[model samples]
Target: MTMKILISDPNKCNGCRMCRTACAIRKAGVCNPEKSRIQVIQMDECDRYLPLVCQNCEDAPCIAACPKEAISRMDDPVLQTVIDYNKCVGCKMCLNACSFGAIGFDEDRGRPFKCDLCGGDPLCVHFCEPGALTLKDSAMIQYDQARTSALRRTVGIRR
Candidate 1:
């Protein structure tokens, strides 16, 4: 079986933000949306709701941007790359490097946090009742960049 990557269908989303709540709980052990690795953005004017999370790029820009070598991938069962807050310097370079705007800052903790696929099974995927957020086979991960570019052209959304 192929490893999977998270995908969001803005058209299917209803802006309930359950994914964000679940992400926060799994990643931070809290119920705070602000602490969530995933985020839900509601474009009220356009009537679109987008759930954004780390893309886990093959050539992860976040990993390259971290001067501290704070980010690394887990290669055994899951290939998800994650941040090591201990090595992070709170400089926010990785935050700037992420084009998808998936990396999030913990204001109180002063470190960058992003989706780690919940160590294998993402809580956000489990809690996404609308089916807006789902995991697709990793083969599509490379194509997502081009697809997202096309989506951006259609919707004019930066994220």
Candidate 2:
């Protein structure tokens, strides 16, 4: 089976926030942006809205940061990093460890949450009116090397 990934095209996004509402409803049964796993951040400097979600890093910092080993990468076809709520200790380490600010903290639940791709059918992608969010096979998309370089620069990590 081909590995699937979620892609966000900022150029296509109009900041409508329908994606956030869909995600929140699917995940939390509410239309709250704060509860949405996917977030659209407005870049005032560029007047652009960027939808941010977990990149599913090969070496996910959130997994390593969880002291209770609650966060882990699912094997094989899924390839998603998930948090074991039973084992999670309500720590915000995963939120801090995320480079893209993809992790969200739930104040009521006292837990951090990230995108799970909605078990292979993302509501965020479906509700995205501008087609900014897409689910594509990993093999079909060309990797952006500049993104890696920029991430390293942002984190001050040389690798």
Candidate 3:
């Protein structure tokens, strides 16, 4: 009943870029990373490939900042944010507002592009060669549990 976002561990990613190719193929009908919704920024010296995708934030600033209301959470159980291209005004407000740098400009369509989680079955997750990406439930209870455990060992929070 909770929406999920995938994150890549820098240690796991090997700069293979299979995720980027998969994203492009699913979104653009091609295997070109240049047109891919997801991007893999390679830090070659460090042997790392940072897989960048939508974080699917609970308080999504992009949704609030869209002037045309083109971005909306899907009614499905996963509740992914979907951009209605027809309604998008190409103002780039959402792109600027997204802190994760997940949004990209579609030069051909003149609209911003972002990961929609592929309607619950993310191709990036499927095609991640190193198993660097995963779609897990974004549960508040789980987050609270982890936070509480971390805080208990820290000097900041007593409880």
Candidate 4:
């Protein structure tokens, strides 16, 4: 099965962090961004917030850099990349290899963690009030391109 990633449009984010809260609640049974797998980075100067999560890259650098071989991909339809916490040696290699800054340090365990798309359902997307996040297949890239082009045109005309 083909795996997909959810991208957040900075233009659509309002810095509310509802996605983060939802993720934490779903994964850890709490409502905290610090424990949440997803992170929302806000650029106050630009009036924008960008939610970051694992992109599930086909050639994932994190998986390759893992010396302990703790990270591996599941064969499920959603194609989740999961980490074997038992095998993890508390190394930060995966944390450094991820291009999107998706992996975060688990302070309690001194290990790294990231979004596994909530086992395919993606709790973040379900709780996102602004609909800023959506799971899209590879085929949806063209749709995203078109949407961005239209937005650019609208902005250009306004200016």
Candidate topping lDDT: 2
User: Candidate 2 residues 68-103, lDDT tens each?
Assistant: 999997775545788899999988999889999999
Per-residue C-alpha lDDT of model 3 across residues 38-107, encoded as one tens digit per residue = 8787767867778888877778999999989999877565547888988999999999999988899978
Q: Write the per-residue lDDT of candidate 1 for residues 46-140, one digit (tens) a residue.
A: 77999998877889898999999998876644557888878999999999999988998988889888877776788888999989988777767
Which lDDT values do the candidates have, in the order given? 0.84, 0.88, 0.82, 0.84
Ranking by lDDT: 2, 1, 4, 3
- Candidate 4 positional error at 133, Å: 0.8
- Per-residue lDDT for 98 in model 3? 97
**What C-alpha lDDT does candidate 3 achieve relative to the native structure?**
0.82
Error of 2 at 21 (Å): 0.6
Model 3 off-target regions past 4 Å?
42-45, 140-159
Better candidate by lDDT, 1 or 4: 1
Measured against the true structure, the TM-scores of the candidates, in listed sequence, are 0.77, 0.84, 0.79, 0.81
Ranking by TM-score: 2, 4, 3, 1
Question: What are the runs in model 4 whose C-alpha is more than 4 Å off?
Answer: 142-159
TM accuracy, model 3: 0.79
